[model samples]
Target: MEQSDRAYQRALREQLARNELTFAHAPIGQAIVELDGTWRQVNGALLQMLEYDEVELLAMTFQDITHPEDLDLDLGLLQQTLAGEITSYQMEKRYFTRTGRTVWALLSVALVRGLDDEPLYFISQILDITSHKKQVQALQDFTAMLAHDLRTPASVIAGFAQLLSTGPYDDEVTSIARRIERASTTIVDLLENALTTESIDSGRLTARPTALDVRDAVGTAVQAALSAAEMNEQELEVDTSGLVPAVAWVDPVHLEQVMTNLIGNARKYGGPHVRVTTQVHDRRVEILVEDDGPGVPPRFVPQLFERYSRAQEARTGSQRGSGLGLYIVRDLLTANNGTIDYEKAALGGAGFRVSLPAA
Candidate 1:
């Protein structure tokens, strides 16, 4: 019995040593916190991440370094984990460093329990995401600059060109103004998409769904895109005989944005003829936009709606795009509790179907 006990003690000590070595050398921040939020142990990575020495961190609780606005959510989730409601929790949270700089981390935490199944302490792993967060902020700032610097000049140029096209200008001059108008309008639309992307990505835009006539939204989008279609010599048509006029429960602004993107996409990439139609399916409203151009290549269909995704044709074609339109459409539809799908059209081109809840 004495030999057996000695062997067991040696095995346990080896296990503990291995655990200590792993904890000390982890690449990311790792910490053990007491049940009452006091820092019981911390690794060197955590010390560097927080710009705090080991002694200072051990003397402080997580609450002391967490941002005030994020503290409540963190505490709530921690309480839930402690009460056996959750096994673990993960969140992107802000932490204030010892030097007073705010940093972002993807924090994952799990409770460590004793042999009797009682809570002993919390183990947390924090992966710093501060660099990624800064990159996203920079992109948003650039988009804002585009909206402010380019949109105003483009709109003014388009307005003057429109007047010259319809006013008492010579035919030759009128034709030049019409070309300028088309170019400027395209610029304005692209800028609008950039601004919308920034708003959506930053969570500043929200969908307010309501029961409204789908026809009005479709009409507005069709009218807004008609000029562009005409400039490309594409025919645009709409058919809504099968739709119930007041059944769609969607945000009106978002619905229009969706339609505009679809119609514009068909005009820019699809064949020379485009059609918009509506129907009812499974108590939902489906708006279908199709064109007679060559369909999307099969290989690119899977990522067609992803942000900044462009087909080879689009990249090499004369009509260049920012690759933001389809991504924005999908996001706006999702916000309104709607969905969009793509298929090969019977018209020998690309097809898009947007579905929304019925009121």
Candidate 2:
């Protein structure tokens, strides 16, 4: 019996030694904190992550190193975990390093308990994400700069091409100018989508919904799309027979953008004919853009409005798109308290239906 007891003790010691080694040398920052938030134990990775020595970190609470803006949320989650409301919690939060640099981290934490189920300490794992965050910020800044810087030149090119198209040019020159105009217009549209996406991501794009004439908005979009339609040799038509004036409660600018994107997409991807129709249903305004080209494949429909997602056919087709138009349309519609969806078009091709609330 004494030998058996000694063997059991030996096994327990081995288990504890392995656990201690794992805890001390894990790649990510790990810590054990008292219920009151004081640091009880911290690993070398935690010290390295915060640029603090073991003694320095041991003397400070988690709150001392967490970013002020993120402290409340962290504290709230900790409390919930302690109260047994949550078994564990994870979040992306910012921390202040010893050198006063702000860094981001993915933090996962759980509470420890005694045999009697009494709260003991909290264990936390923090994965440094500062580099990833910085990369994302850099990419966004570059995209914004590219979009803004290219807009003027693209617009100028489009304007010149339009003038050339009408300036007594021969058929060959006229055709080339029209092609230039189309390409420049496409660039401008892509830039606009990028800028709008940046605005939405930064919370700068907002909708001011008001009583709007759906037909007028649709008419404006149709007029703007006519040149592109003509270039594509596609017939475009609009039917506003049943749409009541001033029935849509939407931001006029947003509505116009949505319509333009829908019409533009049809011109690019649809068949030789496109039709836009509006109806009033249950006091809501519904706008449908339909094209006669081969409709979107069934499998691609689910991801149609996703940013940067394109159908395989589109990716291989003659027309190149940034794949941002439909995404922007959906976002703008959502901002204006509206919705859009895809369907089989009545014209035997792709269709998009936009619905807006009644004013």
Best by lDDT: 2
345: Cα error in model 1, Å = 2.9
- Residue 1, candidate 1: alpha-carbon lDDT: 100
lDDT of 2 by residue, 174-292 (tens): 99998898889889988988999998877688999999878887788777777777765557654445445547999988998898888777777885677878788787889888888
lDDT of 1 by residue, 1-359 (tens): 99999999999999999999899999999999999999999998889999999999999999999999999999999999999999899999999999999999999999998999899999999999999999989988987986969999999999999888777988899888888888898899889888889888788889889897788887788777677766555566544354445478998888888888888788778857777777876888888888887878899999899989889999998776888999999999999888999999877799998889987
Predicted model with the maximum TM-score:
2
Error of 2 at 309 (Å): 0.9
| lDDT, residue 158, candidate 1 | 91
lDDT of 1: 0.87
Off by over 4 Å in 1: 1-28, 34-37, 44-56, 68-90, 97-101, 108-123, 127-135, 235-244, 281-283
